[model samples]
Target: MADVLGLYNYWVVIFLMMTGFYIVISRRNLIKKVIGLSIFQTSVFLLYITIGKVRGGTAPIVADGFEVYSNPLPSVLILTAIVVGVATASVALALVVRIREAYETIEEDEIFEQDR
Candidate 1:
């Protein structure tokens, strides 16, 4: 039962990764693509968070007789990645907005046809 529960998070991570990838690839709208990108980023964040979890562990701060503590590195790295990911998503959405303004359509094929 413990092993099965532990594997649940892995399944979720895999599902999120695959769903994000599919959305990004199968969708044609710029806004939708951005949403998919965010999903992908969220999965990455979740992976880090899940990997950082430690059974019978406490916070990194000093405590009375608490010897087991989860590694803080993954969480720290995830925090940085989240910030960068937010920045990236903002930039991408901004670009999408600009494209919408210039082309009057958010669809990739529409933009291509308009360009031609």
Candidate 2:
């Protein structure tokens, strides 16, 4: 029980990842697919944050008598990833809007059917 509690973050990450994957795989609506992609990205962000955390560690700032400092690299990388994800999501949604305009529906099957 103690170990399970200690690793709860990992469990949650796994659950979020699976849920997002399922949504993306099973849902045909363009907006729902975008939401799933966002959820998947969120799980990745949480995973990075969890990996960057150190027990009894201080921030990367140097101070007197601080021996353990968490690495700032992962956090920085995640920040960049977040920016890129937002940009990609916006573009994707824009495309979805165009798709809706062209096809009159956002469902994947409907879009393909209309394309035929």
Candidate 3:
């Protein structure tokens, strides 16, 4: 049962990644693109967290008599990645807003037409 649950979680993460990628590639709306990017970033974080989990390990914090600590590297890496993702998302959203203001529309094709 536990293995099945773990596998299900992995599948969900994979689906999130694929869905996010498809949205980013196929959507024409600037806001939708940013949303997709955010989704993709979040899915990666989920992957990291999932990988970090131990079957029966405890927290990595050192204690007087603790044993079998889960790896902390993955959590730290994911934290850093999440911060970077937020920064990237913010910049992308700002660019989208600027494009909308300049072109009077959020559609990618419309923005490209205005650019040309």
For model 2, residues 1-116, the per-residue Cα lDDT tens digits are 99988899999999999999999999999999999999999999999988888989988899999999987888999999999999999999999999989889999998888778
Worst 10 residues of 3 by lDDT: 62-71
The whole-model C-alpha lDDT of candidate 2 against the native structure comes to: 0.94
Q: Candidate order by lDDT, highest to lowest?
A: 2, 1, 3
lDDT of each residue in 70-112, candidate 1, tens digit only: 8798989998999999999999999998999999999999999
Deviation in angstroms for 104 in model 1?
0.5
Q: 1-116 in candidate 3: lDDT tens per residue?
A: 98897699789999999999999999999899889989988998998888888878888899877777888999999989989988988999899888778789999888788788
How displaced is residue 84 in candidate 2, in Å? 0.6
Model 1 superposed RMSD (Cα): 1.5
Please give the lDDT score at residue 21 for candidate 2. Answer: 91
- List RMSD in Å for every model shown: 1.5, 1.7, 2.0
Q: Clashes in model 1: which pairs?
A: none
**Lowest-scoring 10 consecutive residues by lDDT in candidate 1?**
55-64
Whole-model lDDT values for every prediction:
0.91, 0.94, 0.89
Task: Estimate candidate 3's RMSD in Å.
Answer: 2.0
Clashing pairs in 3: none
TM-score per candidate: 0.90, 0.88, 0.86
Predicted structure 3, TM vs. truth:
0.86
> Candidates 1 and 3: which is better by TM-score?
1
User: Higher lDDT: candidate 1 or 3?
Assistant: 1
